[model samples]
Target: MGGLEEWKVLGGEGDQAFPCLEKLSIQWCGKLKSIQVLFPALKELTLSGMGGLEEWIVAGGEGDQVFPCLEKLSIERCGKLKSILICGLSSLVEFGIEKCDELRYLSGEFHGFTSLQLLRIQDCEKLESIPSVQHCTTLVELNIRSCRELITIHGDFRELRSSLKKLVIGNCRLGALPSGLQCCTSLEELWIVSWGELIHINDLQELSSLRRLSINGCDKLISIDWLGLRQLRYLVKLTIMWCRSLSYFPEEDCMGSLTQLRELDIGGFSKELEAFPAGLVNSFQHPNLSGSLESLWIYGWDKLKSIPHQLQHLTALKGGGATIASDLESIGNEIAKKCGGLPLLAKVLGGTLHGKQAQEWHLILNSRLWDTEDGNKALRVLRLSFDYLSSPTLKKCFAYCSIFPKDFRIEREELIQLWMAE
Candidate 1:
């Protein structure tokens, strides 16, 4: 805390004597720090929304390991935190850190986490590297995202080739896939997005056991080579999106090779891409592979906004229900026209006139406010929103008074003063 002012930290050393304390969460405790917490029996710990914490200084004990029973740790949105130490947390299995904007580094001896299975790091804008996890043989899943300043993944993961199954990397500066990944024959799922620095990934063909692959929004990537993806007979799903520079897909022969492929999603390629190769669609629809291709999503049409189709809305008024009066139907038609094919607008406006008296319905139909255009289109749809009111000023004040109880009396001066204050 630096003794700058008052601070609030949870759990004094006296709590260490409690053997049954299995879970502890310090949230929105702006001043909480390592020096103020000593929970020896805690099995899971979460720190969130801590605004003043600068670093997590590892705790020490007389001679034994601290946090000997701790297995799960999650830290999020501690905006001022810079670093943390997990060197002695040998029993930790799951670790997740996110949204600590000032964090620049993680300093710890990470090799001791023999039990660590899942690790996720996200939105730590200044985190520069992931400390070497080459020793985490039991690690199974890893996810890293939105760490734009994180240019390097320090782990080689040579020993984890057979253990790791899922990997995701997105919106980071990580330059290239590590050579160790070439030996990850057991890896099944992979997702990469918005990685601007990556230029080549031809080494991926080594993953003969791979099943799902997704690559998206990587502006720098230009091609997926045949040798890079052809041998994976087990591949079932593939998606490539927003890689504008890519002009080609694996050839028809290469696609025909994937007997198990079920879904294909490719989108956002630029106009330079050549027309579909001679037999690409034919091969996909071949009698031999008819049932294999279950879903195909191609979004190369850049000018297309959405699927063009008529939208229909079902409502009591739109159904020409028995509740309507003959005179107000014209006004309802006008409102529907103003809605301009949007179903939600028609419903809200239609519901406004439902169950109204004939006089009030006539007043709404004759209101002059709807004739004038508002400054904003989206806002215009709701303009003169309480169309039952007569004037612009009354439109603003009627909503406030609409909540009053039936026949409630109010002095004229107080009502005027309230409107002025508003």
Candidate 2:
């Protein structure tokens, strides 16, 4: 609709009436200023790239229950849009707005949607505030990202702590969490990010149901209470990244109580971090780490090597032509478990047992090599040297080469030709 300045109506009298229409998408109608159509049965509505649109009000006036059955509403790239009202949309379940920079406010009581479960508002730079979800008891996921001007997340959450499973707030300037977030005991996954005024997450202790916690890019954040964190027995994955002011991590005694903890990551360009946990806690030990801790561990931005740099591609060893690709993979899995992310150990182990049977490799993997000090020393001493060639044919080749003068250097190509001729 390049020249079309308005969209007045849709569907016709008979078969074109769209009586069963469940979804409608309006896009690239730049001249369109208003959506003067309504679909009572529409379950989803998407409007995008309509540069002139200022407001979308369903055909009936303000008091009518317009879109009473709408389930999802998505608005994108309509920068001039100022308002959207879903006042009585009782069946609306999900609402999303993206790249609508001119959106000043969402004009509706979010509490009106009894079934609203997800609200995602992203990249709306001029948007100032959102209606509270304190009264919406079914809200499960709330994500607000890059709304730099957004300052308040209304405090009505405590009155009804619904089963909110995920909450993500990023790149905003809110100084603190909404007042009653501490009472959200059913929250499971939480992510707080960006250069916000929120200095600490000490208020989130009430999230007893939390399993994953990620805090990143908070430039002002300084400390975390690990003693409080140690009590979260169900916490599994913790990621703290790019928080330039954080200077402390959990003490060893607190670390010991995290038996259910699995993954821990910490990295940022902070000058205060000299030696991790060393100055943070009096003394720290790896033995204090929980047994169920399966995946990564990190501390300080400068001390740790990147994953891609340290864990080499297994195919690199195929260049040595010692083991074929398929066989090397089985060997790789076993070696990774024993070496604990040491590339040298994996490479040496792979080359050392190149031609060995699968059973032999498994036997070596099950050994106490990683536990005993002498065993670790033995591994450091071991190498995939040429003398260990188990094949008698290769051994004879080495012995026969001694027939030549001691200082004479033999070319491998000539040796292959001689062996083929024999």
Candidate 3:
């Protein structure tokens, strides 16, 4: 009935009891291993930093022993725990296990988890396959990240796909998406990142309900079938980055079917690309994009020379209602010379060059200083803004922005945290 705090256990002699406790957290109890019957009404339990604990139960002879009423459970960095006993917690809806290296198996059937909705497993290097979800129809979100040994999405994807709205698989060895993913009509957002062996994802076209899609660091991907994505009328954001084999964007009118597209990011082009696609800017003014397309980013085009005339059409759309933006900082001088110092290029470079040194500032505008001749004087004028950043802390914080990949918008809070962590 009352809040209990800072109770240290010297030895396992006393029979601790908290009948009214709904939340129990056990931390740093070096000698504690098996939890004796206590807190019968507990709804949430957290076990963290308990190094000496080995197993949840000592031996057999158990019938609904620990945490019978627990609905939420979390176990972090408990290296000695081999298996999590979920047989008794019928009321559990959310469960998380992280950094449990010794955990190799999750025993039991999904039929018992009638009330479960969210399950997360991360940094469990020993885990191989996820428990079959034949009966957990209530599950809405499943996140699996950094599970190096996990190789498959085992079991019937159709049964689990209908209820799952968000599925994220990152930093795993999954070579391909499960074939049953097409049955997931309710899926709204899907993200795949750093999957080394993933070569192609043709089944994504069937996910008509998808509203946001992102793919990054898929080095093996050589081509994308943009025609398959036109069916997603509700899709608002499409981002593709670090896909080295991708050399060109889709045809000029390829994305014309996505009427609701508000943002598009195609960055991390391989250094082999000599220039932007011929009709890239014209594609933005396609019938589908007339007044809808608002933001666009194209980065790492090493040999890009000038902005296409169609880009000027985007300026008209921006003047009318949309807000246009680009991350072509490297080609700012080329763009300035080609467009006769377009206001958009000047504005973007002004923000990117703010607080940078005279020489360093010149380098951003005149991308290849050793090869360019026209922008040396213009770059000198851009260095005047560097005097604004006088504080040591702020200077370090701004300099840290260099750590992020180009086109990345640094958040104010994240910048401060990175500064303080240093």
C-alpha lDDT of residue 34 in model 2: 61
Candidate 3 lDDT over 1-422, as tens digits, reads 01322243355422255667897766656556655445567888877756665565413333234455778888877777777654535677888888888876776545567777888889988776676765777778888888887776666768766788888888877888765877888888888877777877776677888888888888877666666776778888888877777665665565667888887766665567666654455566676765677766555555556545555445324334332223434444554664345464466456655534346555655554334344653453344333445677766765798799864435678888888898
lDDT of 1 at 1: 23
TM-score of each: 0.67, 0.66, 0.66
User: What range of 10 consecutive residues in model 2 has the weakest lDDT sum?
Assistant: 310-319
- Which residue pairs come into collision in candidate 2? none
lDDT string for model 1 (239-291, tens) is: 77677666655556445566777766656654465454323444454443344
Q: Which stretches of candidate 3 lie over 4 Å from their true place?
A: 1-17, 54-66, 82-88, 101-103, 247-252, 277-282, 301-309, 315-422
Q: Report lDDT (Cα) of residue 175, candidate 3.
A: 84
Candidate 2, 121-189: lDDT as tens digits: 999998888877777788899999999988887656775475688889998888777778778888888
Off-target runs (Cα >4 Å) in candidate 1 are 1-15, 61-64, 248-252, 277-289, 301-422
Model 3 per-residue lDDT at 31? 55
* Model 3 quality (TM-score): 0.66
Write the candidate numbers in order of decreasing lDDT: 1, 2, 3
- Clashing residue pairs in candidate 3 are none
In each prediction, how many residue pairs overlap at the backbone (N, C-alpha, C within less than 3 A)? 0, 0, 0
On the 0 to 100 scale, the lDDT of residue 105 in model 2 is: 83
